[model samples]
Every structure is written in structure tokens, then in C-alpha cells.
Target: MNGRITVRIMTVVILYHPTMLLNLSSRHIPCPAKTIFGRRGPLVIEIGHGNGSFLRHLAIRHPDWNLLGAESSLGSVSRTFRRLKHAGTTNVRLYHGSGLFILRNVVPVNSVHRVYINFPDPWPKKRHQDRRLLQSSFFKLAAGRLAPSGSIWLTTDHAEYFDFSVANGKAAPHFSVDTTADPPAAARKTKYARRWIDEGKIIYHARFCKESEPAHPIKPTITTQPGTMHHAILQGTIPDVDAFEKQVHAFDSGHVILLDAARPLGDDRLILFVRVDEPELTQELLVEVRPHEQGVFVGVMPFARPLSTPGTRAAIRITSRWLEGCGLRLQQQSF
Candidate 1:
């Protein structure tokens, strides 16, 4: 094939490769290797696999291992997917979500044999420390998912965050911290590692080994079932757009905020822009309130595939009930 034809074919493969992308919007435990990759093998995870250098290296280094990459940025995921596809790496699967979400919801307990977190964002300011990923809560969550004796290897150029992670690992239950060990060679081959190294920055490494099961059982934070249509039926007048005020509802694990209401120029539907904040995922989705012959239908808009999570369900339910207060009668709800 010509060079142009070869480039187009590769681009199509990278864009259309469906099997490697794990959909976090669906609530399926994606471990055991067989479920997603059609075979059983040792499982290894690389959090924040920026540009796919480390992820591709791990896949190439250990072809028998099932590799999972959790990345928060869609752009990075796409770039990494392109690199991985071009490398013909088949043992790896990537998710465009937080590592915590993958551990808590998608990965089964005692399934992971190793985890690599290379040069995570430090969130340096003291006020933003809570935003950092290597906290006590994460160690506890990791403990529940890691196999007995499974280890988490962390590599970072920020000394303060590295020390903070070591402290957090010590404070968390069921993990033994080792700060003197050498990081895996593939860890240093990441883009961030090379950049920091060339700039004369000192890198840090640590290993947190799971020594025992978690003292408290860790469960999936989002309990709502996926693939369900969340809506409500009302027998009274349709909600008035002018009276729509911002409403916030707090739940055990997350909160929902009803931002604003609008009506389409030529349609009888009211659009509600909602913000849902859960521990692992935050989604800004639209909910629609439509007037039907039987009743008023209030549900999540089907235009986008937002995860059917707790906060999402709450947004629909709260909007329905709030409309009741605004002169609409509640009839039924599916949440």
C-alpha cells in the first residue's frame, strides 16, 4: 500500500478499535482478563498512562500480563490509544476515568497483581492536597482491590508529594510501605520521568504492599444500576420555566445540582442542565421535562451516554419532586 493509504488505514484502526476502550459508564467488573481480553492472566494496572509510553512499554515487556490503564483526560486516552494500536499491543485495555473509579467499581477484589502510578499530578498547594490521588483513602481502596502481597509502585519527581504518599500509605490500613526500593525500569521510561530527569530533577519511588485485607469492607460508591432510564410521571400541569430555580441535593456519597432550565424555541420540552458530583465521577448532563398525553415526563436526555450513577438518578428524582412543589403533581418515578 502507498504511504497515504497506510496512514489512513492506521488512523481508522486507532479510532475504531472498540475492544481496548473500557466504558466506565457501564457498571461491569472488567477484570479476570477473560471477560474483556478473552483469556486469563496476571493483571497489572498503570494509572495515568500519559501518552501511552509506560503502558506500551509494560505491554511489550510482559506480553502474558493483562494491562489496564486508567486515565482521566480524553485527549491523553486517545493519544495513548493511537500509540498502543500502532505498536500492535493487544494485552492492554484503557479506561478514560479515574483510577479510584476503576478500582472501586470495575476491578474485582483481589484481582490486581500490581499497580503503577507514574508521576501523578502532585496538587502541590496545601489547600488542594485533597485532590491528590495518593491519599489514605486511596490506599484503603487499593488494599481492597489488590491481591494479597500485591504491590503498588509509585514514581514521582515531586519530593513533597512522594513523602506525603509515604505518610498516607503508612496511615492507611493493610499496607506496608517501602521507600528504599528501585522503581521498575519501565516506570522511568515515561514521558514525565524523562522530562524531569533531563531537567536535573531527582525522582522518588515507593512500594506499598498489601499485607492484609482491609479492616472495613470497601464497596462500589455508586450503587445505582446502569442502563436504566431515570424518569418520572406527573399528572399535574407542566413545570413553569420561569419558576425554575437552582436546587442542590446532597446524598450519602455525592450531590446533585440543578443549574438552569430552558425551553427549545419550537419544542414543548424543558431542558434542565444538571451537575452531578460523585466521589469518582462528575458529569454535567441534560435532563428533559416533556409534556405527554398521559402525563409530564421528566427524565435524563438520551443524547449523551452519561453513567447511570447515584447522583444522576438523584438529579432526575429531585427535579421531579421539585416540580411538584412548583404546582405539578407527582405520579410515578423510575430512579
Candidate 2:
């Protein structure tokens, strides 16, 4: 899509009123308010945190700074979640969603003190370059979200991605790029950093700082015209029965289920349902049986139509068994 088109689409789908908190439930845990510097400490966010090793270390070593990690992969999020739980670390929060989403919806304006992009996937192909995380657009977004004195620290072992990142940072008028001769002393002993250094691959580090206030305020604008149904949902209004049926039909044909439901466990939080044919294969299952008085169950069954067949019946049976194991009971009707 053209840049204008893409921006517009993102504006519509991604942007929301700053006053309204988007995705607040995902960030359930409170962040530590104090920083190591004794003042309200800076908020540091790490993007693409794979296993939370670096974040865990950082949180412990720098107890004063509040930390947040954003990982798009659920598996990675779950792994990090457990690791933090086991270690009893309370300074960090995990956002299991896109970095862009978090930046737009969750992070307050001029709220982030630092950002770390560590070894993000390099979509190497020429046509796929747009998929690379460090792009001109992202640079602008980062600049807007960063505090006036804040900076972004990026590290990569891939030569091409490093070069691309440097070039992108330099091209942005707001950023002043700095290339380091050696890894920061504080970074050297980490397992990932050590391994990269041992391989004789020179790690590239760059600090991108915004030089001035943006000429324009970054506001959410709807870009892609939301489908009729989604438009209704966004407006806090339910679509008609036909549109809802079409949505459900679409879900039934697909293998995934995306449900917006009230927390099954008597918590004030909300729950998202990801329906699977054989839940056991996924390893863990936690079903909430009760709902908070104010919450309602919202389920998005991806393939509801075709899955009603006898062959698919086994999958449903397996799913039910798994939910039962997790202490989730089937409700007699939508509560």
C-alpha cells in the first residue's frame, strides 16, 4: 500500500483517543514508580524481548527504574511471564501485543525514558524490507513517544539490519545517531551479548535521540475503512444480526477463535478466548468459571460453521475435556 494509504488505515484501526485507555487490561500489573535516580525513575521499554533474560537482569540490577517488555509472540510472553513469576520480580510488566499497538495505546505521550530493540527478526528479502522493525515511520513514532531527554538503544548482530537501522536513524531529522566502538560496559557480561562477541561478530549499537519537538502532534486517525462489523464494534455499538452472523460464520470456517469475553474467573479483568480443536496439545489451560457482575462473555469462534461436522466433533470433545481439566465449566447460557 502507498504510504498515505497505509498511514490512514493505521490511523483508523490503530489510533484511539489518548484520553481513553486502550488495552488497559493487558497491563494489569502496576509498574514501580520510583527510579534508581531517586526521582520518579525513567520508564524503560524493551521491544522483542525473547526470553526476558536481559529484562530480568536489568530489573534486578536497576531496581529504581520501572521496566516494561513488549513481545508479540504469545509463547515468548508466556515463558517470560513464568520466569518473572518464579523469580518474584515485580518491577517489570509484559505486553503481549504489537510494539506499535503498545506505543499508540498504552505508553503515555512523552512517558518512555528509553527503548531497546534487541535482535529483532530481519526480513532480509528486498521486497520484505518494509517488514523490518526499524523504519522511517517507526522512527517518527518512537520520537513522539520518547521523553525529551529519552533515547533509544538498539543492538543487532546482523550486519545488514544494523546498517539499515543506522541509515534509517540518520535519515530522520529528529534523531542524532551515535555508533559505539565497543559494547557498553554494563552490557558486556550478558549471555546474549557475550555469545555475539565470541562469534567475532561486531555488535552494532546506536542511540537515537529526538532533537526537537515534532512539527505535528501524533494523533490516531482511522486509515483502513473498518469493515461494517468492526466499525460498529469500535463505536461501542453491536452490529446487526446479519453482520454478526457473517462474523461468526467467518470464525467457524477458520481454525482460530477470537472471543472478547468477561474473565471466566471472578476477576474484574476481561478474557480473550483462543479456541483450539485439541487444547491438550497446547500444554496449559486455565479456564475461568465465574464472571464479575459487570462483565460479559464474548467469544469469537473462528471456524464455527464447518467445525460442527462429526469429524470435528472429536476436536470439540478434546477442547471440552481440556477446559474441564482447567476448572472451566460450560455456562447454561451467555451470562
Off by over 4 Å in 2: 1-23, 26-39, 185-195, 221-335
Best by TM-score: 1
| TM-score of decoy 1 | 0.81
For residues 172-275, write the lDDT of model 2, one tens digit per residue. 87889888645455454445667887988777778888776677646532111111111001111111111111011122323433222233244443322333
TM-score of 2: 0.58
> Looking at model 1, how many pairs of residues clash?
0
Q: Could you tell me which 10 consecutive residues in candidate 2 have the lowest summed lDDT? A: 226-235
Task: Estimate TM-scores for all models.
Answer: 0.81, 0.58
lDDT of 1 by residue, 58-81 (tens): 899899999999998767888999
Whose lDDT is greatest here?
Answer: 1
Error of 2 at 143 (Å): 1.1
